[model samples]
Target chain A: MSNANAALAQAQSGAVQRYGFTLGCALLGLFLFTGCQSGGQTSDDKAAPVYEEGQSLTMEGTLIDTRCYPLNKDVNRGLDHERPEGFVKACATACANQGFPVAILRGGETDGEVWVLMTVPAVLADYMAEEIRVQGTVRSTGVLIPERVETFSDGEWLTVL
Target chain B: MKTIFSLMLAAFLFVGFTSEKTNQVTVKGKLIDTKCYGMMHDNHTNDHMVKKGDKMMKMPSCATACAGMGIPVGVLEDSKPGNDVHVVIAPAGTFAEHMDKEVRITGEAPYAGSIMPGKVEVKNDKGKWVEVEVAGMM
Candidate 1:
């Protein structure tokens, strides 16, 4: 045992059988990759947790306008019952002849800042692509008109989040 | 310098031993040109069931790439567990070099915005990779 200690005891038993065959092939390749990736992943790769129990949404607050000026439901809430002293110049001339823009998104604490209108592409007036998540439900519309805006019960200026 | 430091370590080991394959979307043909599950019905959601047309494409990750690749899968009905179809296997080679010919798969399209398009890889108009067999609908 003197040939450089028999080549350091055969390189320490060939590094313990190559580290026990690379730790038994990395624990049998991590148990065949978690039994073949639990039915091929998806749904956050099998973490699967998105319980949307029958709609039920209305968390927290902020969505108001009982006379707050931070609502821009695309302006104009100044109808003229035969103008009495030209109220605010007849709501700024019916918000510049019905192209209004002041603020609207009825029933939701409005003091400032909060947007939830997710999708609205019917009959168009701009509003598509919504899903701000965290308990969803958004419906508030107010449009002034002569052809379609009967306080929009179904005129659909798009706004049905 | 030592041959410009061994030619910059052989161009950094030839860009780290080259291995980056992209351009793999294979679909040649046959899995019964896909269209299964109540095969078309519901023009405006009138509902008779069996819904989904325009070439069905979706299924448990295409049945895990067609399990043991004897490749030929298209289901909207059978193998019920949670009905949501789309599966087109036989890509990325080795099912006997994609069995009976014609392959053109190009890759990169994992249901972009999800109207339902989990995977689609087929090519062959000189784009190569023409070995398809995934039709249960588009």
Candidate 2:
């Protein structure tokens, strides 16, 4: 073959090899990214932990009224909540007194999971908005049957119920 | 004899550790507000008391109102005052209108006192069980 033709063919072969290498790397990167995304459980997945019935769990979180928390996480995840009238704010204790479900805002996070307490709501009225530690059995449905509950007060943990 | 005893002990421990399986049960009872029942204990009626100004008065259909406001509703098994109360975890307003009605709930009993209901049926005036539509939780 002529010298110029041989050189042109050699250059074209190198370019093709480089393009193949780049495409292979891109496909591998895409596969790895998708694999990582599906490996971690999302918040909507119900079988995240696959908890057994009566499985014991101990968690620390803030006490919150379940009724209003879902309405407004920032406004109702505390001692006070916005009333249905849209013009009045009410205390969570009064709501709990009227038999609203009280739940624990896990890790005090507004975006975290809120597990409803299976115990008496009226008894928890006094401890609203406090940081609570609960030792209990958790249902697969995510409700907590609290066996022992304590509150963080004055730099110490005190048993409340 | 010693080997047999060791095997038996191991089997007992394995069964004890893994025996807490989820149980599906059907419970029949009257739906009651858990708050009132938990506080008063003896107040099992459908009507509850509310304070108006300085006086406490009976509020008719209070159980329905309370259940509508996201209060946990429980099933008083056999409609008895002192029987086992199984608290149901469901959508907020699912049991609002069914207060004080005879209900049959088929669900998973994660524990002794809590139910995750799959189907709930109430007895109509004609004495027939009718399934109620449950709202989907967000």
Candidate 3:
């Protein structure tokens, strides 16, 4: 094989290994939460899936890590609501880097559900703690599989996807 | 000309990569499944909203069930009345033990978002929030 081919093969292997490791950790998270699933969906999970593909959703809120979002439960934990503009960006950015799934906290009246990013973890991680607009499909599992992600930086809509 | 184009590309990539950071913090709240909490308690019309003497009784059980189904568990901090936020807890061995229970964890916090816990604590029988050992440290 050519040197270039050998390098490409090595890179692909590394990526696959990383992806497997992350997926393993996420699945392990599932196991820790459930123990061993004996059957179908849990009783509480019976509610129909809210997310749908091709559904147009424009949300303005901080990007967050899925695991920690509900646990804290305080929307203004790092951002001061009084100011509404104050936020600690480092926290969200680091949280995603730690292998947690990135999600969006939709601002306004919809306080109940958070948009879980099912598409690209790395791309969404960049906008942590920063307000942005997301357009995507909502999977039955309540995850937002994004098709387009944009952030208003310096009055410009910067598209991440 | 090639160098100019390369520099422009590098600048664009730099902007893309440079815009990121995360915060570290210590927090306390009840651990519950996202689906259960959002669909149940958050939605007043939902049947799970059944209240007994002003408290929702089914929350704990529902949270436990959802957690078992591989759903992510999060901490609900109600410190600020109207601004309640959910921070998803990373599942470690000790996490399952504290499912649907109150916990105090110290880790990286993003503004008002999730936590990548460095240390976690759960209340013991005596009612003290003592640190518990997790299989892995996030």
Candidate 4:
């Protein structure tokens, strides 16, 4: 064979080889990029624990009638209300039975934070003015989605509802 | 070309982040008693009927009474079965009087199936939306 023809063939072979290498690298890079995208999506699906919001919390407080409590914290924070004769006094249990928002007045202080209990009020009416502990998630500020509720009675914590 | 591509990518990322951070939702529906609705479903009406000792007795839905009693109120977007009932996080009796009435609530949905209402408006008799003052809302 002629040297020019042989050199020309060698050059063409080297170009084809380089083109193949470039194509192969591009394909590999594409596969890796797609794999990373899918992997990232899966990780996002199995999201990390959310600590800032939807945090599980346990709070101890006193059961109060949310309706009347806001009207008069001192007068309505307890089970009973003071009223003149012939005028029926409003009580926490009555308000609860009437389906008023029942809340846990933290520490039983009139000035304490009120966490509205997201539960059946009639079920909780019996425990009004009683010390209780609620375990659940805080959906928002002062709103508790109770998982379990226990009332302090007779020197012990009893699961009431 | 590279700069333009980078700018477009950055803008998309910004939009994604902003949307992810937006958790506020507004829902308009009829308020119903959560317990009775759970027990009665579509059968839930302004009142309910129960068999008391072999005698079927009709009774009021008592939704307002239940709300005053501390039962969480549920809002049904429609009567369609399998539809979600959004629980309103507000003073128990706040929505009591508006039970079975159409209401529009705006609030943050911190979790699924719940709304921490910031504004609650009920549709009046004249078809006007009236905002009800939510008591004890922190």
Candidate 1 global TM-score: 0.23
Tens digits of per-residue lDDT, candidate 2, B1-138, equal 334445545655554454435567889999988766655555566798756899878878888877776667888899998777777756435688889899999977543366667788999999899998765321
Give per-residue CA lDDT, model 1, range B1-138, as digits (tens): 334445545544454344233333333231221111213312111112332585443343332232223222222222232332222222211222222223223333222101111233334457554434432112
Which digits, one per residue and each the tens of the lDDT, describe model 1 over residues A1-161?
59999999999988977766665565555545554554364444456323231233433222221121222223322222122332243333332222211122323332222322121112112211111122342221121111111122243332323
Q: Tell me each candidate's TM-score.
A: 0.23, 0.48, 0.38, 0.52
Poorest 10 consecutive residues of model 2 chain B by lDDT?
A: B1-10
Top candidate (TM-score) = 4
Which ten contiguous residues of candidate 3 chain A have the minimum total lDDT? A76-85
Residues A5-41 of candidate 2 have per-residue lDDT tens digits of 9999999998877766665555555545544554553
- Backbone collision tally, model 2: 0
Q: Rank the candidates by TM-score, best first.
A: 4, 2, 3, 1
lDDT of 3 by residue, B13-105 (tens): 554454333466767776655544444445211123436797766544554454444345566674232234444445422355566566787
Candidate 4, chain A: TM-score? 0.62
Lowest-lDDT window of 10 residues in candidate 4 chain A? A81-90
- DockQ of every candidate structure: 0.02, 0.04, 0.03, 0.17
Q: Which of candidates 2 and 4 reaches a greater DockQ?
A: 4
Better of 1 and 4 by DockQ: 4
Which sections of candidate 2 miss by over 4 Å?
A: A1-47, A87-90, B1-71, B74-122, B128-138
Highest-lDDT candidate: 2
Q: State which candidate has the highest DockQ.
A: 4
Better of 2 and 3 by TM-score: 2
Evaluate chain B of model 2: give its TM-score: 0.76
